[model samples]
Target: MSEGAATAATVATAAGTAPLRERNGGQILVEQLRIQGVKRVFLVPGESYLPCIDALHDHQDAIQPIVCRQESGAGYMAEAHGKLTGEPGICFVTRGPGATNASIAVHTAYQDSTPMILFVGQVGNDFAEREAFQEIDYRRMFGQMAKWVAQIDRTERIPEFIARAFAVATSGRPGPVVLALPEDTLWGKASVPDMPRYQRARSAPAPAALDALQTLLAGARRPFLLVGGSGWTAAALRDLETFAERFDLPVGVAWRRLECFDNHHANYAGHVGWGMDDALRARIRDADLLIAVGTRMGEATTEGYTLVQSPLPRQTLVHVYPDAGELGRVFRAELPIAADVVSFAAAAAALRPAAEPAWRGLARAAHAGFLAHQQARPAPGPLNLDRAACVVRERLPRDACLTVGAGNYALFPHTYYRFQGPGTSLAPTVGSMGYGLPAAISAKLEYPQRTVVCYAGDGCFQMNLQELGVAMQYRLGIVLLVFNNGMWGTIRAHQEREFPGRTIALEFDNPDFAALVRAYRGHGEVVQSDAEFGPALERALAFAQEHSLPALIEMRYEADGIAPGQTLSGIRAAALAQRAPAAVP
Candidate 1:
């Protein structure tokens, strides 16, 4: 597969003006990716995609493939890449086992609205109905999670499929797409012209819709802005901030979307997700006008549809999104504007407020509540996870990237740290547990100079801990802080709340994570108290930066201290008291 062959073959095909050359499906697919500006690919090698790997060997100038330790890790790295870049993070895996392993990140991408593409190497076409080894119908398996799923049969259609994959993955309500490549099809050859690169189709808000939004705001006593989901450009975020500043509207970021807005902004409110501050939640519930942009207002953000009622919210709702289908799917909107973030934000910035905002005090109070929420008190443990989060925020540069997987521990960083934009945060809104480590690795790989830190719980870290080997292999100097409490904190809190002391499979013992990091040929440390943390962190960062290797600090904490200002035993005691006959009433 040489460019010279493509150029020298001047015999144009009968159907087109451009010359066509005999190229295998793998070569064509890779070339098409090159034309689409794919700089890197994440994958775990398999025999099914051997031809593609062979093509990669010759076309090294086009794309750099990062080999991962497991299919899941590869998929996660790709998902993180997508979150950071707003492009389709590409992943390649083999048939059944590989595809199944990679499905976790695919689900995260789907729920988080990140653009990504997963390429699975399928069985030969000859074995279509025989249920061959390592074979599964991806179209059926990934149909629900992915925006589109299909298999490439004819080699000639490779370019067409690739182009459409990019377009669909980046279009409205951007999500993951799956494309399966049959082994036989990839090995076959065809003389065909390449399809041009795909561009994201943008939709702007109609003028009347903008007018209705301004009218709604003008009439309201209180209005709020909630931003999240995906397909957001930096310019869009700037314009959104401009709109908020002009209207003096309170802005709250959706779950795991700290990147959506600058936390330091005066109009910024507290995090609007699970375990949100009571003050902010009440403010949202009481707002007269709610302008929700980009976010789908999922269960986490809406507190199980209680904050803003489904079907018909009590507050007048102005929903803005790239896709129209999601506008009325759950909550009916007074004004539904189907426009991409870029366009909607631009329009919003340009619109003149009908009057001076009546909700200035409300916005100021919301920002105050957000600031107060960041202040952490002592927990029932030696290690102050919240203080450690503050340490990372203070010591690291404002541009440093922070990654966290889902756990009770994640709440600390979500609460304490201030995010600048997309470059600073990598978290899974769908609450996937093993996302942090790989996401940190991906961030470091993408931005080698930026400081990268990962926060994970004992249970969450163990889920994809083996990926440490991949980080060590790549010499990615990422610092990891493992909050070890010997239990899955989130479930323990819930279990204590519902059943008191009946803890079952949720409790588990963990290995020495510091030793595990050492075994992986990276720097390691143990910090159990507040005094040991700062010094240990400094050492870890110094080691990682100087040695160009990963570093881990195992910060041990008490199991009873489940969350900030919350204890498991206290919860159990409260539950038991509630269960014991309600005062004979």
Candidate 2:
């Protein structure tokens, strides 16, 4: 197991296949990744994972290792890769602190249903149970969040475990997996054969289920289609859209999954999440038959389960999901189909209504309502976010990719921007802040041709702002829009609604963000008013493209304007009016 050149051998695995190669565990793991066509890996280097880092050096041509600022940033980047490609995004971090820091992304991936694999460098076997330096039982730490969690115990078992990780990550409810690499096993050497690349498995609806769905649709006067979740192919999305069009069905993209369907289509209903219009909410609530595809109809999409009741929904629910466990986990469905999105969409597309849908006008009305909701509204500030968002929608290409972290500013993108379809947008369903920048970096690296825009609030942007250095080093031309309201905007709005003018620990002063980006050798600017926003954004976009660097625009608006058409003063006044007089108490 010396650092010398590895030797090749002809030993075969149980199944008998390729010739075995003698190399360290690190080399075997990395080779398996390369064989699986892994082109990129995100990592925050640590001594714990030095062996794997060295192995990555030899395979530089086949795999690109991106060194990020922090483990969380690396994890976020990896998670974004998973969302964009529908493959297991690879991330490497150290044990203990590193693994703990990256847990947020793991949680996000688990909830978002994105396929990702996080590899943590662990202490050697000899140090087991002795509380070695930076030692942690990742299985115990990540068991609840990750789909699967285990450690590599020996060099010879590397291929077996690696193969399983990929399969587990991409299976049924595609999710995150954690594999801890003990240092002793990683540095040890053995002659072992690599496992074959893993194949993804999917479930399809039964013929009877298809017939049942059509029968239900035939008897319904109003039917609505809801779509979201991971493992969606462009062709599958096309099929789903065709199914909706053929059925004249109003379709609501679930929660932050705005990219699940074309926003401009006539059958396109409004986004089914926070800030959704009343008409769209009514459509989801009042529809006689609710056909949910892919999405779980999580709390956010269901508005805390008021729109679609759980256990027993008011509407006739036809839930289509890949995992059988999720079929009846919550809401009771009239027809529960266990099928992947692609499979269900393909079959659903071929179905013809028994008669013309009774609600063609319903679909058209929903789309019209969605379009009308996008119009700009007056706010209390000179810097209106709706206007700025409209400018971005008009300027950027239709296929541009937009990423957003959590904050009140998220409403702007979720409400205003028109996502072309799947792969055109990235946002956390679990509401994780600090995701926009890292996700944008991953998107820019993956596509390179399309425009990538990241929208974040002041608080959200600062969470992993250090990752801006990674974008600069990689020369990714990404346009970042920071909505700087000089406070934790979302929290401040909540405080105003509940406590009404009694706010604390919410407001904070900010550094000159433009100056910070300029220090990284990237373009930066600030816009203080509506008139300045368009010009600043134009310059930032041009500079990023021309210089092959990141460009950041800081839009500083009135702190009074927490969200679109909602001001702190207005919220406070309304709260005060609703409260009983202090004298009565």
Candidate 3:
């Protein structure tokens, strides 16, 4: 798209006026963002950003600023937006403490390859050495975590730099970029030259590469594909499945992949990590050919980064990612292709490969074994996390979006729920709390038609429950299911298992979540016993559907010190023995 056409028509409107009126740099920044196709900007209100807030309010129609409860939640919400739409999500916060507050989500976005632009309002331009209130060198503070970190000290550079920030954020190796704008500069008057939007060029595989890939697929005794990240769209997923089926290849999703394919598909071998059965783990070791797309093969999926050392030596690993760095960064790859996921898959789909029925059969058997294992060890009573996850999965609308919070409790949905479409589930691979509520809000904001459900533990939910008001304010019909297990279940379990009788700050309590939800003018319901689980979910969904607002469902299960990291069911049963009944009012 031409630079002029890339930006919206407002620039043209501004230019046609013979009488030019200079506006605040902040307003110019908002206009530039709006022209660049930013539909929403998530933020936490702060004194330092008053000028930017005013400017945003002035241009509210062109760009919407979503007020979040916490700065971190705002960043997560932005990251989720970017995950949903293949665009750079925008998050604005104040300097120093505000930037620090949002650091976790920024790191989450960085690690997950979720494109986001975090604009932090800094101290006055002349106050750097003064150690003023909330003043800190943001570039230094956020340098390590962000892809690119810069401070905007001059008003004239706002438009061009910000436009570049968006481009860098959404480009290869997509990640969160930081822009620290000084408060004084934001209020300064400047005429920003019209900046246009930018779109990345799609990549295509070379004919030689395609030929090699096809030959490898045809000759391999056991070929497999691993899907990861939210880079693929539904159409791309379909094409991938078609290509896999044509070659009769097995498929396993990377750990916490957003959505790759239907788990019920006969050839699905299950996720690579997060406690898969021995059969699937063995399949990874034995597979002769492995083709990975849009995945980093991060530590979690690599069996705690042991793919190189332990039981699995490694196979012919082929990686395709938009980022060149991720190609061979993790597990060394036999063939690494740098290209956009959908385009690369499309290119691969055009190639022809010989069918391997034996490979297909092995894949089918592995899937069958995994399914049987799951069926035998069903989630049990006292509000079984696995069973509850299954129930939630059943209750979710077709193609519903799921957002998982941090903590062992989040493993409930991460392990149990199967996402059939791309971008259906969002969770921070970094495993940070306070991600769910904001992510849900962002999902709902982006895809209003789809049901967005957030799964959070009590400890995690408390980290950002205030976003409930943001949901209500936006009239976002998202459902929040809080796994209210009292204390920090994950840490407690660690204490119980590793250092028994040494629980310290992990033991803490909270206000009644249901009542708190009502106080925020949203619906709240408590599920005190196992019997109320199903009913509570139904009512929560109904309330969201009826009111067109967020609903909080606090399912009070016995924490029992069961940590999500425990791989065995026996561990969970043993953990349950340590519970003391605590009911939510």
**TM-score of each predicted structure versus truth:** 0.97, 0.97, 0.89
Residue runs of model 1 more than 4 Å from their true location after superposition = 1-18
- Estimate, for each residue in 64-155, the C-alpha lDDT of model 3 and write its tens digit: 88988888888889988888887889998888888999888889888888889998888887788799888888778888898999988887
Return the clash pairs for model 2, or none. none
Highest lDDT against the true fold, candidate: 2
lDDT of 3 at 111: 87
Per-residue lDDT tens digits for candidate 1, residues 479-559, read 999988887789888988998888888878789899989998898999998889999999999988988799999989877
What is the Cα-based lDDT of residue 371 in candidate 3?
71
For model 3, the stretches where C-alpha displacement exceeds 4 angstroms are 1-21, 308-313, 355-358, 373-381, 500-504, 561-569, 572-585
Candidate 2 lDDT, 1-585, residue by residue in tens: 333323334224344666555788889899999987799999999888787899999999999999999999999999999999998999999999999999999999999999999999999999988899999999899999999999999888899998999999988999999999999899998887678989999899999999999999889998999999988888998898889988899999999999899998889987897778888888888889999999999999999988999889999999999899999999999999999998999998898887878776888988888998888878877888989999999999999999999998999888889998867999999999999999999999999988999999999999999999899999999999999888888888888889987999987899999999999999888898899998898898898888879999999888887776778899899999889576755
What do the candidate models score in CA lDDT, each in turn? 0.89, 0.91, 0.77
- Against the true structure, candidate 2 reaches a TM-score of 0.97
* Reference-based lDDT, residue 177, model 1: 95
